[model samples]
Target: MQVFPYSIVAIFFIHHAVGLSFGSIFNDLKDTFSYYSSSLISEQCDKRWIPENITGLEDDLEKYLHGQDLAAEIIISALRSHLKKTYRKKPLVFTLHGWMGGGKGYTADFILKNWFLKGGRSKFVRKYFARKGYTADFILKNWFLKGGRSKFVRKYFARK
Candidate 1:
């Protein structure tokens, strides 16, 4: 008779303890999930594509690319016109060709840094360098096709 009462008391205490533990576990899980979801939302918001700053780009070009007024003017005007249009049939492309040490690479780097939020470090920017004896198609097939598609891609072919 006394044992029966003691057994009931023990069972009640055990049940209450288990219920409290389970409640704490659930609350902890809820907190973790909310933190994870909020972080994901913030990361997605940060990943949005930022627009180019044409005025700032022009200033940088004029300041850094001295004696290249003609080239800078042409590039800036073309980019401004292209960006102004809401609808575009195709992507804008630029081909820079000149003798070695003519600032082709510098111009490309500057344009990328000015155009993108993260500049050359961004995942959206891709660069492919062509080695000697590698044709354009071969390079495109092997290098470009293997990698995931990016918003901007630059290909540099070495002069034979």
Candidate 2:
């Protein structure tokens, strides 16, 4: 009779062990399936985080702009305001006449340093939004380089 009680205890132990092992296996399988369907890797990309390198608005366009959000907001606002008041259409050949050093370049650097989510051309970046209707404005013409050297102008500066 004592031996019979020991057999029952052994059966209870076996049942608990089998139930726990099976439950764990089922849970693991469920997790693996969920990971793939969620467009993420299970072990590889669990704790994904965005790097601190975006720049557009000092506030909005967070993912696309990777720098000082406030500066971009001011610049974009200023550019829009300037364009709104005296917007005009001119030929491709014009002058940056008085203004130089190119905030456009600095702007591009700022954007590139802060925003680039993926690989792309400059136009696809911050400039192309106005590039279509305003290509004639501010005089930054796109030029092809011959052997990647000559900056595509038909005439060179007098000193050069």
Candidate 3:
């Protein structure tokens, strides 16, 4: 019998939908070590989130930027200066709301974008959703995929 690698164990822990089958843990397998060069937070995929040219923690999205408040004063001040120099040049007013059957890509045709937060994978919520007859795929569409660009567009594009 051979011992399984810790890296595979971590991947299973993070992505496994159900408690691991005993077979996976006990099965004979080669152990390989895999580590990331970046912090877990920075490992997030490049998502269409927030304003353009605004990569780091600076604007209203500052709340979610990892280590923003703990950053040094010099860095914070530099970020603030950058925002000031570029704020007006970029779109500022933004709105978020719910709409029904609105395809995410269609909204992007009008320049709006989607924000996919990772919280759609909460275990408590997952159980709740399952009891309500939703699988992981259904839960994802219900939570993040079915975004709408709001009814305000209706008023603006209303028939005369």
Candidate 4:
């Protein structure tokens, strides 16, 4: 019958479409599970470093440099306010602008060491230094522009 041929074609098309959709659904589930698991592990590994006396932080910072009391005060105040907040807020972007040998990097080190348990070695902090090979264009195109981790990036970067 003519109807038999049409039914067979329709069934074949539907079966292939359903199979493709299920494959995509499986991949989606896998990605979601991996993302959540990694996030949970990250949260659990975050070890906090809270000094016994808060005043010690200021004293420790003073040991390295001289005549930056105003800058130190501002930084301390900002840190205090950040610590007091319970919920997550927007990320704090700090731009330590100064000439070479002006103690910008030193100040950053001191801040991180006092603020976190592992200090500069903490996993939470990602330091990206501008050097000869890692030019701005490379970062803009490959790192920032790519946004998040994807198959294309993983392949390009030679990562898993």
**TM-score of each model, paired residue for residue:** 0.59, 0.22, 0.15, 0.51
Candidate 2 per-residue lDDT, tens place, 1-160, comes to 1223345445545665755776665555565456555633221212131111432433344444454466556655554454355434431221112224424444454433333333123222223323234433322343222221232211111100
Q: TM-score for model 1?
A: 0.59
Tens-place lDDT per residue, model 4, 1-160, is 1223345445545665755766665555566567556744553232223231346568777777676777788877876776576663454456665666676667777766666555666544445555356666766775656543332211112110
Judged by lDDT, which candidate is best? Answer: 1
Candidate 4: global Cα-lDDT? 0.54
> What RMSD, rounded to one decimal, does every model reach?
15.9, 19.8, 17.6, 15.8
Model 3: weakest 10-residue lDDT segment is 151-160
What tens-digit string does per-residue lDDT give for candidate 3 at 39-150? Answer: 2333233232122232332342344333324332333454356447622443222222224333222322122111223322311112121223545676466543543232
Superior candidate under TM-score, 2 versus 4: 4
Q: Write one digit per residue (lDDT tens) for candidate 1, span 1-160.
A: 1123345445545665755776665565566567556744442213233347788889889889977788899999988998788777666777776777777777777777777666666555556554366676876786568663342432222221
Off by over 4 Å in 2: 1-73, 76-98, 118-123, 126-160
For candidate 1, the lDDT comes to 0.63
Name the 10 consecutive residues with the lowest summed lDDT in model 2: 151-160
Off by over 4 Å in 4: 1-54, 131-160
Task: Tell me the lDDT of model 2 at 88.
Answer: 41
Question: How high is the CA lDDT of each candidate model?
Answer: 0.63, 0.36, 0.32, 0.54
Among residues 3 or more apart in sequence or in different chains, the pairs in candidate 4 whose N, CA or C atoms overlap within 3 Å are none
